[model samples]
Target: MPSYAVTGSSRGLGLGFVQALAADPSNTVFALVRSISSAPKLQEFVAGHAHKNVHILQADNVDVASIKTAAKEVGRITGGTLDVLIANGALMHHERNKLMLDEFPDESVLDDDMLTFYKTNVLGTIHMINAFIPLLRAGSTKKCIIIGSAIGSHKLARRTEFTDNPGYAMSKAALNIAAVRYASKYRSEGVIFLTITPGFVRTLQGTPEEVEKFFSEAEAKIREKFPSYEGSITVEQSVRDQLALISSVTIDRSGDFVNRDGKNVEG
Candidate 1:
């Protein structure tokens, strides 16, 4: 059976990916969540499935010691061979403090707020891959999937009106570069690193209702400034598309900025 590891599987798009992967009879999914008891949906899904393939491991991304311990546990389970690994945890701290830049540009990035995002989005992801590198190397088709966003695309920023969150966008952009670099270094070992943007998905992190409310307040101003605003997609649709793309990944396709639509996204 193919063994898979995914971060942030407690909820949102991560949970969607876990569910889809678990549906496959030949796959065993190791979901790294913050807390098992708090995640009723995840617990329910795993329980109702009546299969032991779905393993939920507690993981606080910011806690390096916790991640290391969990990695060791997973290493034992898979015998140091993991087929798939996903860096899917993310945060949008900038949304709450739009004036943060104006108030504290110099101190903002270094503050606890932005540092938390980096710890989870960037550093934590690095730790996950590094600790699991040995396991991935032992697998047949070693693939590392890094969840990114269209907002991080430098090309999109230059041409289109995609996103305005500098902290979140910049972090993802940096992640893309790191992913590409990792892919280039390991391409010879049949390791595929795919940087993907799952699209604007409505997930547990932010409900569609909340997004609607936000849009109602800020949408007109955004639309007035940038005349081309493509709306969001459902979480299910985005997850399906992302899973399809991940399924088709190969060494030749590594280090590419890919979107849910199977086309090359610029960055």
Candidate 2:
């Protein structure tokens, strides 16, 4: 059985991944959320669909101990092996979407925001990998996938002149580097560490007007970057494409940062 663990599986792209993976009864799916109460949607889906293969575990990304504990539970359940570890937990403050590096109110505020992003997006993911490495090493498909963003790609940023949300972008870039380092270290052990963007996924949840306004602003920004760009994809489509890419990718392409199409995002 292909056993997988997805962090931040309470909602959005993470929830979509859980739904897709759990659909296959043969696949053992672990949905790691901050708490069961916080994941009503996931709980509802599991209960409604009667997906016996889906396991929900509390795992806050900022808490290394929580992640380690969740890993232990997964190891126990999966016989000390895990096929995939999907690190999807991240901090993306929509309010800060338009804030440039120097546009912050003050240096202190900027530092606080950047540090918060770093703690979750970079350090937390590193700790998660550390906690799950043993189980992954013993698994059949040892793939560690980090959900990255195009904003993190220096080449994409330069090409599109999309310079905003510096903290989020910087943290994601650091995460990409972390994945590459892990790939290098674990290549000999046949563990593939990859960073992939889910594309422009429309995972926003809010009032209808709020959602509309958010997408309008986002589309404007996207148009500024790519004139011919279309709208965002559904979370389901994005997860499907990503899972397909994950299944086909080999160790040779391990350290790559790619999009849903399996093309390098840096290009």
Candidate 3:
């Protein structure tokens, strides 16, 4: 059986990955969440999917000790091996004050937000690399997959970019480098570290009128940027596509950054 562990599996893309991977029944999934109380849906899913080999582990991506402890538990259960680990947890909060750097109205907000992004997305993810190294070393495929954003690409910033997402973009860029460094270090051991972008996924649903207005503006920009693009894909489609990409990746392509469609992003 293929053993998989995913962080931030309580919601969004993380939850989708868990659902898709566990559907095969041959995959033993460890869904690492922060806490059971904070993950009611995940808790319920675990209870219902125990027969499906879905186990929920409590761990926070930002909390190193928690991750180490969870990893130990999973290592014992899986007998010291893990096939795939999806580091999907991040700090892309929508409520943070937007900073444009040059035209930002406030400086303190930028300072605080930058630290938050670096700590969670960059440093915290680095900690995961350390905590899970043993399990990856013992696993079969030894794939360490990171959920990165298209905004992380410096070339994408020059070609096409979103407004007011500096923190998210900056942190993601840092994470890309961190992932590449780890992949370089472990490549001789056959560990495949891939940073994959899910490509413009429509995660937020809205009313008819509201949706029309938003998509009209967003889709127009997307079409203007990539003429061949068909706009945002559904979360289910994105997850399915990403999983395919993950399975197909080889040691030769390790440390690469690509979109959900299997295209390489600019370095």
Index of the highest-TM-score prediction: 2
Q: Report, for every candidate in turn, its global Cα lDDT versus the true structure.
A: 0.80, 0.91, 0.84
**Model 3: per-residue Cα lDDT over 1-267, one tens digit each:** 999888888877888888888888889999988775788877777678746688888888678899899999999999998999999988775455355766555787668778888888888788877888899999999999999998889998888766667888999999999889988999999999999998776655468787677667878887788888778777799899999999999998888998886788884
Q: By lDDT, is 1 or 2 better?
A: 2
Mind giving the per-residue lDDT tens digits that candidate 2 earns over 1-267? Answer: 999999999999999999999999899999999878989999998887765999899888799899999999999999899999999988887577678988988999888888989998899889889999999999999999999999899998788787778889999999999999999999999999989999888888889898889888888878987898867888999999999999999999989999889998876
Which window of ten consecutive residues has the lowest lDDT sum in model 1? Answer: 93-102
How are the candidates ranked when ordered by TM-score, highest leading?
Answer: 2, 3, 1
Q: State the TM-score for model 2.
A: 0.96
Off by over 4 Å in 1: 93-97, 105-110, 160-163, 204-208, 215-230
lDDT per residue (tens digit) for residues 1-267 in model 1: 988888988888888988989998789899888777877888889989856689999877777887888788988988888898988977754544464334554674447666776777888888888888888889877999999887788887776554446667777888888898999899989889998889766663467687787655554654565677555667788889998888888789889988877688862
In candidate 3, the residue pairs with backbone N, CA or C atoms under 3 Å apart (3 or more residues apart, or in different chains) clash, namely none
Model 3 alpha-carbon drift over 4 Å, by segment: 205-216
For each predicted model, how many residue pairs clash, with residues at least 3 apart or on different chains?
0, 0, 0
